[model samples]
Target: MSRVAPLAPPWSKQDADGINRWGHPDRTYEPLLLVRCLQRHPALTAKLRALGEALYVDATLPPRLRTIAILRICALLECAYEWGGQAAFWGPIAGVSEAECDALVTGADVGWSAEERTLISAVDELEATGSWTEQTWTALGGNLTDEQRMELLIAVGWYRTICTLCNGMDLPVEGWMRPWPG
Candidate 1:
């Protein structure tokens, strides 16, 4: 395992409550690891984070594709918390299979649609290579709406950052989750 970063402060009820009630994340809540996310710039962090969730998870992307992109980001970042948190579909919007999800983690394709396969492969390549191939953009760009394209494009960075935060904090995936591939 990689060395863990120093712990930040735990998020308090006040912080949690704010996030829970107001739907605004209090980045400062987790201090033990000194992520100091809150201190950096609340407005900036909040907007960025909100944009991330709004575009990637809550937006119109199919649940399967959304989860695939997210899980792929988790795999790339090796973040159990983010990967594990989305474990049970969290109600509706639950899509995809255990095998498919695992395939994402291992950089393998398990016979998804051309679009599905392309998106996952693109995300993987982006994570591994830092640049996307023209073919990826072409295949995806044609099939996706402008809105979806922008959302997915932004999601690459969004989930990437969120996963890093979870990994840095050593946050585990929710209890019910089974290491993705299981």
Candidate 2:
């Protein structure tokens, strides 16, 4: 059970707005547990949701790279709620293979291309040290524009914040979401 239960409907206008504005199409109202829990703090929900939209919708980082970073971050944090939801929904849409998702969870060696390898390594480094090494930054530069690099860093921090929320709240994976891959 979640430490803080998700707020159910008859939502305040503010929460309804936040839900309408920020809810992920796949996750929302399949009970919307996370966003509804967040609606407990409406102001923060709005801001966080907006940031999420910026990262997922408006950012320059490619969707595939962003999804990879999210998977790695959630795996490292052991946040099953976020990891499962993303793996089930966004991962395939972003072309992240099941093998790749399993590799993320188990740290298995996979035949990822050079760019994919660098992105995984970068997420690992960030999880370990909270910043990328110069070598990793240089490697990223080959494939990512400056804006993309910045967005990647922000995505890392943003997803970490999300994982913290999911894990700390003891939020259950939605019934529709894939469970954590072995």
Candidate 3:
């Protein structure tokens, strides 16, 4: 069961407007777990929504690398709501294979290139120690451009914030999506 149940209708006037703005026109709260749960604080919801959209739209980081890092964070944090949705919806589009997705959950770096392994290691280290080791930073410098490195740091922090929200609320997975493996 979810730790905090999602908001239901008849919502406050502000919340109703927020639902319409952030949710589907059909009145379904299908993919708005984060949005719907925080809609009572419309300002905060809008800011988070904008930040999430901005992270995706920014081209500084390649989507595949970005997705890998995000997935790793999700798995490390054990946030099924975030992990399941990203693995099912975003992974394929970003060229992350099912095997790679599984590896994220299992902490197995098999089948990844040296650079990819380093990236995963960075994510792991960040979760474990709250900072990347000097070795990981050197590896990233060799593989990623300055802009990409910056994007990577921002992306990691961004996804961590998302995982906190998703997990804190125990957001339910979308019906069309499978739950992350136990």
Model 2 steric clash total: 0
TM accuracy, model 2: 0.93
Clashes of each: 8, 0, 0
The predictions' CA RMSDs to the true structure, in order, are 5.4, 1.6, 3.1
> Each candidate's lDDT (Cα)?
0.62, 0.86, 0.79
Each prediction's TM-score against the native?
0.71, 0.93, 0.84
Tens-place lDDT digits, model 1, residues 104-149: 6776657888888888788888888877777877787877876776
Question: How many times do residue backbones clash in model 3?
Answer: 0
Worst 10 residues of 3 by lDDT: 22-31
For residues 64-150, what per-residue lDDT tens digits would candidate 3 score against the true structure? 999999999999999888888788777888999877887899866568988888888888888888887777788999979878887
Model 2: per-residue Cα lDDT over 1-182, one tens digit each: 79997778887776687767755665544546888788888888888888889997787888899999999999999999998888888888899988888788998887888999999999999889989888999999999988999999999899999999999999999887778876
- The per-residue C-alpha lDDT of model 1 at residue 15 equals 47
Q: Which ranges of candidate 1 are over 4 A from the true structure?
A: 1-14, 21-45, 56-58, 90-92, 107-109
